[model samples]
Target: MDAMAAIKQTFFQECEEQLAELEIGLLAIQDGDVNPETVNAVFRAVHSIKGGAGAFSLDDLVHFAHVFETAMDHLRAGRLAPSHEVLKTMLRAMDVLADFVRAARDGGCVDAERSQTLAKELRALDPDGSGAGSEMDDEEIAFEPVLMDQSMFDDELEAAAAPPVRLFTIRFRPKATLYAKANETALLLREIGLLGEMAIACDASALPLLSELDPEGGYLSWTIELLTTQDEAAIREVFEFVEWDCDLDIESDAASAAPDDIDLAALIQKMQATVEAELSALSPPPTRVDPLAEASRKDADASADPGVIDLAKARQKKSEQAVGEHLGPKPDQGAAGGASQPTIRVDLDRVDRLINLVGELVINQAMLAQRVMEAGLARASGVATGLDELEQLTREIQDSVMAIRAQPVKSVFQRMPRLVREVAAMTGKLVRLVTEGENTEVDKTVIERLADPLTHMIRNAIDHGLESPEARAAAGKPEEGLVHLSALHRSGRIVIEVSDDGAGINRARVKEIAASKGLIAADASLSDEEIDNLIFLPGFSTAPSISDISGRGVGMDVVRRSIQALGGRISITSRPGRGSTFTMSLPLTLAVLDGMVVTVAGQTLVVPLTAIVETLQPKIADVHGFGGGARVIAIREHFTPLIDVGRELDYRGENADPLACVALLVESEGGVRSALLVDAILGQRQVVIKSLEANYRHVPGIAAATILGDGRVALILDVDAVVASSRADSAAFEQSLATAG
Candidate 1:
């Protein structure tokens, strides 16, 4: 793309970061954080976006951001209370602002009516005009909205046309840091000028000649008189982001100024001085500032000698001191925010390419080790030792590549609150979304694909798992329902859970629905867990009526399929009246696996080591025939169902004798125990995962395939599917035999 387009792309990338910060700060405030920096951070986010959008001529973004920033400015200066109502308005406005920004970047049309409505609400909350006459000399101003065409903003305004104008003097001085931040003084002047009739006065006394001047130095200040119907809060908002970077002073010059002898700026200065001194005593030192009255003066030295300005050095020193705070360090980091943990954004395709190369390196290393052993090298030989070290290095390199793609799940988690809000509004149910462990890291690809399943599952939790308000009340639950989401690393896998505090899944209802849909026999006797899982059967839904939110039986099945496609498994657990939790276990990365290589029906197969509990040679006494062809094995005082892996995979229809085969004690996603019978145990190793579905069509009993050290391809067994299939085939065989007899 062209350079300008590339620069615009970078700005949008920055916008994403700023938007995240904005949301985080707002949530903190909503949760009762009173940190001044929090408000400033939020204000700076919007202000930066506004300034950047002006550069690209994103007028829609600039106009809407202007109104949004004004409301936030009031909160920043303590003019607006951070109450629940006001904060809610700001939050909604923040979302709309985000929309406007995205539309501007993506070349989409924005909903101007929504933007205009939010702008009106934010304007009302500004505290500049809403209150009745008070004791203050200054008055809050409001604009009777003027009619406009539909292009920039909606013509449907909340208030009427502009009635009159109020004149005020605005003092703005630019610091070196202001220009350093890429803020243009002319842009500010032009935007303010658009609001009213304005006269700009420049002070050039601080400027030195070409021989002595530092081009980057702050040597200019301006006094502007603006006659407009806009409120003073709106005027002050133009400098919100750079307020700390420059000296900004605004005052009312009208006769109606607070019936006091002192002007607004003087009174504000005295109150601020006392407040700052007290604050400094208890906290950190104050930021830099300038004497407002001195900066606002139009007269500089009309009688200065033409050769060199008197006290040029003194004026330079004063101007330097009068210059506002420098572009300082981030609050959490050191004084320079530039020293932030250095990071680079790499393309996803590059990361994937690197991972693929690493996987190949692992395979080559394994092949080299195999050749060394075959060549009769001693275990302690130099060649063998080097090969072992090579293996170690390859593994480390693979891990490092995986780490490059590991990202916190917070990106997906951050979108949940909005989802819960939308669902709650649609269902007319009050839901408080409580999330934890959002910082748990997972593969970037996994996190991206996991969003849809989690979204649908969360919806299912609230709609199907949670009881209605009246029902919850009767069941001794809170009037307001809660949907909880959490993620954590467990046993080298990322386990995410979506749970609710409302009524649990109704097993009887679920079973009836499954039966009506012909998913199960009408009179079938099923366990509670089985009934709970029935909801995942395709076209199975218990909603009484079809509606926009959920009724038509689509979500759960898709959720299950998507999770499985990610090499993950999902299960559900429910307590009658308490709640229900849907847990999904996904591999941290799909590129490699720790697997146990074993021989099954004369073929090498890999079983996920994470699924295995133990291996044993089952004694004849411990094996007992159950129904039809099914059997159970006793291990550690527990009788677990046993499935012959060879028979399940259709390698041989007949069951292998227990004496000739080994039993692998394994657990499924639902914690169901089973003994998988295979021929002989091979060895455990890290196998680079190769997708069988991508190369060949998917195999039902196999998950994926991997290459052995000796260049043999082994199918990775889907232990869950094998264990589940055995029960179904056995039940069907028993039913058929009974019918034939």
Candidate 2:
């Protein structure tokens, strides 16, 4: 690949990894469970990506990296603790960084407007105040020299005979008209320094007397002796820029000559020809030289007055203007400057490949352990003990690799505050966003998928669940409504709750909307939970008029779909005139899930353990049809919606075999329900989620497919979609019964 292509690829890869690490680290920090090492890791991940981008001379990456690295530096040094506001701002900055990287990868310039807005948000987090200068003392200053060490060179020489060093004598002479051009000799020299070491001697013998001099004319020349481990082609790079401007000659130094085995004669001849071509380009025609010389002399004489003007300050101002012009506006320029933080850009595909490899290794390790147990090799010889040790080591390695993929949910959480502000402003609701447990660690894939659903839920909480400012005051609550967003580990799953303390979902309005939308009949008697879930129905909205913020009847349905796509579920709990909480339970990682492996009519199926509330064998008397094939089992006084999986999947041969069925109670749009009629309950295991879209296509009731331990592909049951489909069927059947009556 070309330099730019390689750079773009590397940038995106590094960005993905950095984002993952940022999510996990921020989540841990927000949960108050992160350590100094974790904080440092998070900071370093961002810093590394920035450094890599800088290496490619990408300006947009450098600009944002500088700002983001500064904030992370502060956090790393404990100057800034994980606060709700700071974390939110950091998250927003990360989003901007992601955007910039994406734009750069696509060969587009950074989005100036979005970048400026995000930078302002990041700067506001560290406004001039209490903790400004405290973190400086703790910042670590470290460096990695690019030069090869003498000891390493010696060791290599001892292993394989040392390669011959080449020395070249180079003469650089600039053309008389060269000074008029914008190119600088110093910059050229700096570029050369990146290649090798050299000694220089300036020749000013051609300089004329002060009276006869042209100040702007180039008179100086340099003879340099370069001692490099690189060949003659490398030496030519030093003088690459000045090739057209100067007279150049290159030859091998006799003093540094090695054996005849390593010849330098041909290399020296090529270097001389390369330099000559470059120098010839810089030489101008002799006809126009006199006028330029005269102009230079006159200009030099006119500026001879020592006290004529404050030229230094004028030059400084001009330089500042030039910098401003090149860099555009400096929105956060006043905050601080001169922070040395190294960053690197990595290719996200590579990181993803690495993660996949690690996941495979984990699976292989499990397989090996299973084989060892089945073989009954505990009493075997030394090889058995070594295998045990290897297994332990493998486990540790797998854990470390998995840790590299762990990212905080902070970046995903960060966009919420701005969203909340916007939605609140639009709805005229005074909503204060209270974020907790932002540091919850999740895989990168999960974090990316979670952003949209979280955004919709937060918007729903502010717009629909939270009351208006005036309404809040009248209800004897604080004038400003509180929307609490929290994430925590609950039963091995990440539970994210978007709760609002305002007038909760009005059940009466929900029922009315549901009735009008034909989602339910006017005479249908539903529990409070079922009534609350009516909000998730497609085309169901209680709002009388649609607004720009929401209530076009599309938010919750999308949220539900998004959550389900991630192999997660969304649930709601509410009290009339109080507030509502939308709880989303998601797996820690999307790559693999802890699933209950069960067999239904000889086909193995995986049900996400998170969705399995309680599995039981329901008595035949408990299962009864209300009307028109709508089955409901009386669980205490409340009736639970029941569906027979065997009948639903069209499985044959056991429709009425004692009516013994296992009920996997799952939550959905119609609230919690015991899914009746499954053949048997199987053991639970962690199964890798494979995309059905790759081989086949999406099946309505099947969320995804996973490979069972026995190598059979088992479909992961989509409890929510199945429940929704079953409920729709029940509603249709009931309507038919009404028509028949």
Candidate 3:
């Protein structure tokens, strides 16, 4: 990439972070957070975007961000109350600001009408129309003593007193990182010039000979003479981004401030000429190259780097990409101009490559250990001991690599608030989204795939799950419906729950709808769990007519399939007239896992160790037959249902007897416990996961397949699926028993 292109890339990258902060801070204020820092943070986010937009000459972005930041300033200064009406406008304006940014980044068109509409609304927020001055959010204002001429004292008697002109001597030394951060000294100097009359002198004393000087090194500094009505606070604000990052010192230069200081005036004049001469010696920039035009220019070639504008790519890639895609910005990149964690952005392909290499190493290590075991090496033999140590090292290395791919679910969660707002607006319902555990970490791939399912779930929560305002008020609930979204790691899996405090799924109504749709027999006797499960059935719809949201009976089924595709499960729990919660349990990483190898009907299977609660040798005394064939095993006063793994998986034609089989007690995501009847238990080991869906196709009860240390492919059991199948079997058995009776 060329110099300008690279710098433009960094600007947009930083825009993503600024946009995140802007939305979060606005949300915080809207949520009634009274922290001044939060309000200031919001102001700074928009201010930074505006500053960068000007540098890249993104005129539209600069204009929109200007008005938006103006309204945010009112909140920051406590000039405007965060009333629902006011915040709603600001939030809408934030959406426009994001559109402007994405348009500028991805070379896409934005609705000029929408931009104009929002700009007018934001401007209306500040009737006084002094928003441009509000951009000094980070400036530490100090009205220091300034010299007042005797003439000014006399002028107070005859006319009005004028503001004092303060002289600031700025010593700026840019570090190499400043350039690396894509910050230009020329841009900083230009911003400084906007404050007042400024003369800059380059200090090249530290510059080495041409052969000795490093091209990337900052061997020169500048002495700036600034005289303006603005305070030192305003002057320092110009360098706020790199305050502590670079060598910067600012103070009053009183002698220079004096209008009659002829010696200093002469020195500044000479420096100004020399600086201009030096600048003119350099090559001129392109007259037509503009970041603003390049991004949104439809006429541009296809080389408009997908990395720059990914929303366009996502739109083409996933049909489920909703209105919220690329709507909200990413979280704060870090501290201003300095990354706190010293993190670097790496391409996903590189990370995936590393993950694949580690998987190969894991497989290779398992093979080596198997070879040693088969060679009859003594347990304490040097080769055996060395292999054991190597195994441990390989496991640690694999974990570290997987950790590299671990990202907070916040990335996906950030987009949902926008989705909720849009859907709620479209439905004309008052809805509030409460989120928790956004900091909970999951694999990046899982996080990315979760966007569609989560969008569908959130929409469902608002459209079907949440009652209308009138209905909620009639039900003795608050007028505003609430949709709570939370994520947490439960039992070695990431569980994201979308719940709504609306009238829960009407059981009778759901069953009637299913029956009416010919989805189930009219006289079918169903359990509560089965009724809840009916939502996942394909082509199931409760809505009387299809609108923009949720009447097509498509989302819930697609949600189930998507989760299942990720080696995960989704279950629903509802209470009539109260609420319903949809919980999705997904693996932390799809790469590798520690599993308990077991035999079922002579076929080896891998049971996730995380899923296993305990192992038990089922005693005849503890087993009780429930119906025709199903049984419950009593363990510690808890009657857990029994599922014959061999029968559920169809590996055996006949169901295995509970007492004769060892039961692997496991719990599903929803806390449903079941005893999985396996023939015998093999030892535990770490196995690398190879997706069956990728290699072949998805199996019902099997999550994925992995190669064992014995060099054989063993299916990984989907514990949740097995538990669910057991419930279905139990329901069938009870019905048959009733018929027999």
- lDDT per residue for candidate 3 within 1-741, as digits (tens), equals 599998898889988888788889889888888899888888888988998999889988887787787788777777788888998988888888888899998899799888877777776677476643543542488898987768657857654445566777789998867766657777788789899777766654464332233444466677787777788888777887766347998888554233444355665667667655543343323564434223323222233332122323422322221123442223442223443334687878999999999998998898898999899999899999999899999989998999999999888888888888899999999999999999999998899899999999899889888888999899899999999999998889999999998889888988998999899989888888789889999999888899998799998999999999989989899998889999999999999999999999999999999999999899988888877577788999989888889998889888787767799999887677888999999889999999998999878899999997768899999998888777777777777777678
Backbone clashes under 3 angstroms, per model: 5, 29, 1
Q: Residues 1-741, candidate 2, lDDT per residue (tens digit)?
A: 598676567567767767777766775676676588888777777776776777678777877777777778777777777897787677667767877777767767767887766765555456445334443433576888697658858877785665565676777777743444445665665555465555554444464433333334566666665656667777676665446556888887555444453444554455455444433344223564545434433554355332212334433432343344333333443211232233454556887787677667656655665566677876476757776677577656655665666788877877676677668768877777778898889777888898888888888888778877787788899988888999887766788888988788888878987987899888776778889888888887776788886768888999987887777788889877778889998767766666787778888888878777777677777777677556777666667877767656666533534256677777554345656557787786666677786689878788889765445578988867677677767867866777778
Cα misplacement distance, residue 488 of candidate 3 (Å): 1.0
lDDT scores in order: 0.79, 0.69, 0.81
Question: Which regions of candidate 3 fall more than 4 Å away from where they truly are?
Answer: 2-6, 129-261, 265-339, 657-660, 737-741
> Using TM-score as the measure, which candidate wins?
3
Q: Residue by residue across 152-270, what tens digits does model 1's lDDT show?
A: 44443423343346667788888777766667777787788788666555455454332233445567776676667788888877776678778988987555322233354554454
After the best TM-score superposition of candidate 1, give how far the Cα of residue 712 lies from its true spot, in angstroms: 2.9
- Clash number for model 1? 5
Looking at candidate 3, what is the lDDT of residue 219? 60
Regions of candidate 2 where Cα sits further than 4 Å from its true position: 1-346, 354-403, 513-527, 541-548, 609-643, 652-655, 658-677, 681-686, 709-711, 719-741
Between 1 and 2, whose lDDT is larger?
1
Report the poorest 10 consecutive residues by lDDT, candidate 2: 333-342
